[model samples]
Target: MSGLFVPMTKANGLGNMPDLLEQWAGSRSVARAYGRAGLPMEVIQFPETWIPVDAIRSLFEISARAAGDRCFGLHVGKDMTHKTFGLWMKYSVQAATLRDGLIRANQSSRFQQTGGKVVFVPGAQVSFWRYVAPPMQTSSQVQHCDHLIWPTIRFIQSYLGPLWLPEWVDVSYPRDADARLLEAQVPFPVRFGTPYLSMAIRNRDLSPRTPRPFGDGQRITFDAVRASEAAGPSNETLGTVFNTITLRLLEGQTDIDGAACQLGIGVQKLQRDLRREGVDYRDLLNRAKRVRAQELLSDTDMTVIDIALSLGYSDHGNFSRAFRKMTGVAPSGFRARKDQMQ
Candidate 1:
């Protein structure tokens, strides 16, 4: 929960970077860089997959050595789009405002990443976003830090239109380790050795914008929900177990008894353990359903009935009551507002 957890798709920039390096540096250099980083030549070959955060950081290191003092991360982060995070990215960008978009991204982030979560703090004139992570123990973490901050800026840029820029960028690392190339790309000041790695933007920039109208891509993004299953906490903590059950529910498996059996425990024992952990099984289930329902209402054209069925509800009436109890809005009403705002 304190350290970074990244999605496999985060390394996808490496696939595109080799070609970019071949263009900016040379094909020979790309091979040599990968080799120096002790990676396979096929490291340049990109696939649509999700991997652990540490692994992606390793790939970023290889790309960095290959690029050699060039602004590697800045370029890679700049080219990022919704496709980078698949469905989660798609749903986030379609939010009503930059703030709302970021919150949506944070909610759906576990669908793409589970090691850390986005923390947003609002102020009277400015707002800050921190990709909170645990203490670093690996050498490759710095690379992941760079990747996290830059892509976030890029995502905000895409949401607020290209003219957007942050007030400043802050990093948890020492100032001397700063990359000059990255500094050159940032329009605002970059400060290092801060308490948290974060970005600050003016509050006005967070104003809500019009949501996008309906489109076929919405349905395609909805179908891509399965891709997010790869993201989960890599530990055995209760939160991790909660996330696992949530994923199972999303996959149309909702039986807590079966989940307990899968965990090699009886249902009653599982309940006892959850109580010891200060969580109720039903509460976890409700939270999971709430998150899933919000995503469907905001990002898909799926009707309330279809969404309820997908969440394993007996009927829309039951779904509506539960959704309202949790979110204070009916499914159809939620969808309507999302549509009108868009």
Candidate 2:
């Protein structure tokens, strides 16, 4: 499979209005909610076009502000079922096993509004499928984290039957609000203020368990979704390239030729392919570095110098210059602003 896919934007919220509005508990008008969130009414009404991940988070913010319920995301997650994600959900649901379903969901996360990827990490006792996303500590981000994790929970229960549950659920962010609403819904213990976000599964349960056979029509729909996504944009390939560069950077491997070799292409071929898609390797590297740096600065209390070294900068001074050039603010200043806002 291609490297872990990260979409250019978080998953779109096209088909989630019914659930979100329902979660609002009729406290506010749809028009008022959209206006409050600064989202277009037509977008929520039509929902044919993809909404940004940020916008989905904004919707939760507005709902929380207007409804005074932090559990809004958990409520909205109830609608993120087969119908919400369309064919992608169908593929996941009809897979041979729960593991297969999670794999299918992981591959199509870009289309599913997952905003990030679900990675299965193996352990000696209990392995887990972890939800990975770009780091930013905001109420909206916390809600977005819920949007990514809770659906996976619901999907597992649906795929393995209602009796199924993950061994446990772990989230990176702290519990800033009452989690009783979520605890009541989940069968397993729900944990907060963890190092990462993950749903641990028993190692033995990772095997394929034939649920139900896929109907011919379901197969057709799955194939069509795959084809549509393949033809939609080159973001998947670009994401793969960016992931490679970032991983290599962490390993102190920063040469285009090395990345080309790892990708099994000649340097010239890699350059030509990226150029065809209007991508510059250096610019892409810079963009990835900027994003990684921002995530570290905002999500962790790591020193600026430490973050710079982690990003492969020779020194903090060079990292700061590049950061200011790209973001128009020093790293310290950015962190201070983010801290105040959060």
Candidate 3:
């Protein structure tokens, strides 16, 4: 298999699109749409997983057609919260100012998708935050682009107020039926057929501003998120395989077939690819399970049973034995040691 087979993206990049689709259409329609898009329903079941960007584009088209709404992406974006992107959004929001936050987001954009770039360009009077989509042709670019642009506007609104608007927004795709729909949603002008997708913000609005507060005590620190991202998958076949396994493990799924499906490949081909990298699927699964177990024990307050279930362990004794075998300590004892160190 070629390394450049298809571009992959974190499922979280789809944000609340699935839920919004369910609300507008129905659960059955959502299933049909996933089927038509050549994506397993498990992708939605585990938003932490990675899937092909093409599949996402297909989903956008099917969803829009089913709902008879050209601006479905905009609606999903408007309904999104900070939780849409999870730790990435948390890390950005923790910055000292909105400008700092945008810089941080640009730096950590890889956490959401691959083969795309988020550039933060500064100007004397105005600044531009641009999203460069991957070089792929699709009829659904408008929907996909709109999905990304509006949440960004909302992020700016976090620093500015709810009534705040951008000077103007740019869409890479040409004008379509949704152009008027897009215009109606934003108070500012919308430009189409531009070089790339971007929005203009005044330098004054990008200045120092207070971050929103999170009352949840379980909020992960910005440093922790950064460290996790730094330790993420590399640009290798083994790294991609390992990342897919880790994400599937979070949803209590450890089957090789599921991982292969998420990667848009076959089970035998996946095994062959891993062998070429000189690693076995079982070894990677065990490694991912151990890493996830340690993270859950140290970073969350969930009980041993819940953690075990999340890792796909059907029996508590089995999980305890595996945990001890991997880390040389029981889950409870591990958590205790982590707490003491803290």
**TM values, all candidates:** 0.57, 0.58, 0.77
Q: In order, what lDDT does every prediction score?
A: 0.64, 0.65, 0.79
Instruction: Please give, for residues 221-252, the per-residue lDDT of candidate 2 as tens digits.
Output: 45676675552334756765675565455444
Candidate 2 residue runs with Cα over 4 Å from true position: 1-29, 113-115, 137-139, 147-150, 214-217, 220-223, 235-342
lDDT of 1 by residue, 72-92 (tens): 655665666545655677777
CA lDDT of 328 in candidate 2?
100
Q: What is the lDDT of candidate 1?
A: 0.64
Candidate 3 lDDT, 180-272, residue by residue in tens: 888998778989997688989999887766755543635556567667666444645766787777766756789999988877689999888
lDDT of 1 at 250: 44
Model 2 error, position 113 (Å): 4.4
- Superposed Cα deviation of residue 14, candidate 3 (Å): 3.3
**Candidate 3: which stretches are off by over 4 Å?**
1-6, 42-45, 137-139, 208-222, 229-232, 246-278, 291-323, 329-342
How far residue 25's Cα lies from its native spot in candidate 2, in Å, is 6.4
The alpha-carbon lDDT assigned to residue 240 of candidate 2 equals 57
Pairs clashing in candidate 3? none
